[model samples]
Target chain A: MNTNTQTTRLYHSTLSPFCRKVRLVLAEKKIEVELVEEKYWENPPDLKRRNPAGKLPVLRHRGHMLAESQAIVEYLDEVVADPALMPRQPLDRHEVRRLCAWFDDKFNSEVTQPIMNERVWKKITRSGYPDSRAVKDGLRAIKEHIDYLTTLLEARRWLAGNAISLADFTAAAHFSCLDYISDVDWDRSEAVRDWYATIKSRPAFRSVLADQVPGIHPAPHYAELDFG
Target chain B: MNTNTQTTRLYHSTLSPFCRKVRLVLAEKKIEVELVEEKYWENPPDLKRRNPAGKLPVLRHRGHMLAESQAIVEYLDEVVADPALMPRQPLDRHEVRRLCAWFDDKFNSEVTQPIMNERVWKKITRSGYPDSRAVKDGLRAIKEHIDYLTTLLEARRWLAGNAISLADFTAAAHFSCLDYISDVDWDRSEAVRDWYATIKSRPAFRSVLADQVPGIHPAPHYAELDFG
Candidate 1:
């Protein structure tokens, strides 16, 4: 077997939530991806060549370019197909996929929007103007999303039912970044908080926590803050 | 034998690209999911309860809730485990996943952004101010995205190469909508245009073509825009 098939090249930024999602999946599958940090905001020609839409966390493997965190992670799970991050049931797997999408789509828009804009993206894109209205709205949106999360965590140990499936990683990926900004009211929703704490403490999560923004300082408790 | 354990429920909208993706997978699998039309825009309590984010195409199977189109479709393939949308090798699987994510994420932003924003979301959200600039930007984004896609299609019969997979379906789902708005410059990429023609003619795609958005008139030749 040609070793080229084993090569996983991920074009991502440490501050990008989507990149972290792919990273966690790689860590889970014990697959090594050569991480290339792309300055997405500056719009590199190489990055645009990899992903025309200019989104972060594009995975190039097996001589193919994979864009979208969901597809990248699922591809990882499929190729590895061991230590499965998803349940075997068709329905159960769907459940995991659904939550992964939720994190990337809805949660990112509502929760991560302001934090990234106010903290990293604004600086990178050099927008220079921070909309206090957007920041306030994002904080409020986080609370609502958290309340919904509370209901889910109330009955299950993980974000998507009982297992440490893709859903948990997806949720944690987004939340970890918000936690960095201290945007997460970790005190609310003890079950969810505890669940996050456990995920944060995982070996896979250490790299995500280690991610730093040049102009942004994580909350003093950011590193030490554990869930629950 | 209790059939409920094997049965599936698809909560979706007839007009949604994400929902149509699930429909394509179901058609491919020949596994039936009781179709549940979800009014994602209405924000019905039940739908919101099932999907706190209030998105469409939530799949419920064997007492589990699956949200997000990418996750739901993969979950379906996983549980069904026949007519695999993924390749046998790990690297090849990554290729498929990457392609799927590409169409769903990048294509959504580039192509579907304008059509959905102009035709559906604007009407639903009642955010009356529609920026022609954004619509123009969306159009421009796709031309570039299509060139990249055309390059990929040059070497492969389908989006992910070789066999029909999630990538093609995801692309078709978005393109079909763009076609509705007469937005795609099909002449720009003969390969992509022909590939789309091939997809829209699939047995599973019949329903999608037949669908009519409430207040929008699809291109006159849309139904007849066939590859064959």
Candidate 2:
């Protein structure tokens, strides 16, 4: 364990969308963090000690242990204002948060969790063979989600509104995870593809695009800036 | 079908913890909201139109549709200043959010969802009879959660800190739902029971106490202030 109290440290998993959201915000805000990949599924004894809830994406900053990705990202935005992830107006901030929850909760249930469970976790944990039915359901659900994003992007520059905010990063975080195993049907919507392409090209997204999960390989176009 | 946009209207379900959390915060802020019970499980056509994600607890305030319980509650707190639900300090606010997620995510998954699904939802939706194994597992999980809350209350007056915050309401939301069906073993932890008693006695909790789902009955001691 790195005992540098001055610097921030994050314990997270590679493909977990929740952890990726925090990492995106950290990188976006230009906050240099020491990333420690934690295999929380194995039930490490110290994991519960770090976070009583025993969840991942735990951040240790200024000697305070912060759990919950949404909460941690919001804290980072509050403390560091260089590139604000949240908007100034309460309504706009609410929109940002609503979309964040949409991805973290609804999208996760319908798409990320199911897809990852079948495709990624089954392979990594050696739990069982990938359930084709679950994977198909997740794939089918993604089309509707992509269409929804396309509708949102048609009216605004970002997920929440015109300005780039936490909503964009939050959506991108989930998309990046799904993209890792080539689950996303990028060809379905031009608007969504454009939106992802713009967000993916950002310097903050570099760390996420460069991620390689031990045996799993990223899609051919996962790292490309001009994939479209 | 209330067309009055002047009055804040919340389309929600009676027993959902997410909806209850929003209702609690709104009541805490002294915000009089018109509640319209939505049958979200049936996926009403307007539900998808109101919230693209097709979830309940959609708050229409100032002609803007707001989804996501946590985000909606946070917005209400920000917009209304009296009896602030969030602390002023960044770290303190983070603690509040962390606990909110702890209940909404962890507690919901472990205790509320399974127990409610088996005991309440099955009955309400007329799907099937309660699954004993699932209910037993959920009941078993609650003891550990109550113990954890007992430990938290030992240090502070409230869940997150000395003063009442969103964390308290978020926790009470889940507990209130479980309490409705008598799923919570309040006798397991005196500290947790005391904490619940204190929060449950507040005016904000009245709306939750008055909650009546169609066929399912609330526990006899559910509404009593002196249950302990």
DockQ for every prediction shown: 0.58, 0.92
Best by lDDT: 2
Q: Which residue pairs show collisions in model 2?
A: none
Clashes of each: 5, 0
For DockQ, the strongest prediction is 2
lDDT of 1 by residue, B104-183 (tens): 76677666866678766787568786778888888888888898888889999888778888777777777877776678
**Model 1 pairs in collision:** A66-B98, A79-B90, A97-B71, A98-B67, A197-A227
For model 1, the superposed segments whose C-alpha errors exceed 4 Å read A1-10, A27-36, A50-53, A58-67, A78-83, A225-228, B1-10, B31-39, B60-65, B120-130, B225-228
lDDT of each: 0.77, 0.92
Report the poorest 10 consecutive residues by lDDT, candidate 1 chain B: B1-10
Please estimate how well model 2 matches the true structure, expressed as its whole-model Cα lDDT. 0.92
lDDT (Cα, tens digit) per residue for candidate 2, span B24-63: 9999998889999987888888999998888988999988
Model 2, span A1-228: residue lDDT tens: 678787799999999999999999999999989999988889988899999998998999998899999999999999999797789898999999999999999899999999999999989888999999999999999999999998898899899999999888888999999998888999999999999999999999999999999999999889999988
